[model samples]
Target: MAFDERALVRGPQPAVPEIVPYDDGWPDRFEQHRRRIAVALGSRAHEVEHIGSTSVPGLGAKDVVDVLVVLDDPDDEAAYLTDLERAGYELRVREPGHRALRETSGRRVNVHCYAAGDDEITKYRLLREHLRAHEDARRTYEDAKRALAGREWPDMNHYAEAKGPTIHRLLREAGWTGAL
Candidate 1:
């Protein structure tokens, strides 16, 4: 199903762009969220991976931990959303093949929910792993992010969209030939 890009804007927009130095505790924070998500979903959580800038060491980010959770049936929101809500994760974005939840307190987290074998999931993991293994690519990405962060954006989505070219270039260098 083709998703409306506008639907991705379900969350509150940041008033200003904010990018900070890499936090050494990002991995620990991710692990904490991972554990919480695991317990919330139990056996339904097939895979949970830390992605995005925070996942890359020394990469400056918005201090938000991005996590990807692959499930056997992501569309079955009732199976997991309720539990996650009970655990304090507010459902922010809900699309045909994806769902995103944000933690209301403590360290920030974005839990992306996707169906098993979704290409989007694969792309995220591949990009994350590639960045981890290639320092030059990681540096380039950080530079691009830093430059973009200096600009004003109407929302987080706009900021994310502004990073598209650099991201796509990195993905191509990392062996992605599929359409963006």
Candidate 2:
């Protein structure tokens, strides 16, 4: 489903993302969150994997660790949302087919939840893997990100939106042709 503003739990907030150099600690952070999510959801957490720029080694990102958790049914929030909350995540986005929660304290980690078979899951993996294997693509993406980060934005989403073209282009280079 399309993203709805109403799905935003904390409402809109202005942002000029601070994209930083790749950190050697990013993978550890992802693993920490992954473990916490696994324990919280138990068998419900079908799979938990790291995604996004931080997941690709030597790639600069927003200093936030991005993780993806595949659930049997993410729409049924009652099943996993509270557990995540109790474990220190707050609902950030709740669009259909997907949900996003961020670390309540530092907001350093973002957990993107999706139901099994969601196309986004595949897109994320493809891009992450592609970026990991291709140094040139990773450099191109990191450069695009640093350039975009220098501008102002009404919302963090805008910064992300600005990166769409570059992202889709790289995805296509990775052979992804699915709708954005």
Candidate 2 residue-wise lDDT at 111 = 90
Q: lDDT per model, in order?
A: 0.83, 0.89
Q: Give me the candidate number with maximum lDDT.
A: 2
| Candidate 2 displacement at residue 177 in angstroms | 2.2
What lDDT tens digits, residue by residue, belong to model 2 across residues 9-100? 77877877888888999989999999999889899999999999999989989988999999988889998999999999998987888889
List ranges where model 1 is wrong by over 4 Å.
Answer: 1-5, 8-12
Model 1 residue 116 lDDT? Answer: 87
TM-score of 1: 0.90
Q: Model 1 — which ten-residue stretch has the worst lDDT? A: 1-10
Clashing pairs in 1: none
> 100-175 in candidate 1: lDDT tens per residue?
8889785389899999878888788778888989989988988888888866665666777788889889888889
RMSD (Cα, Å) of model 2: 1.6
Candidate that would win on TM-score: 2
TM-score of every candidate: 0.90, 0.95
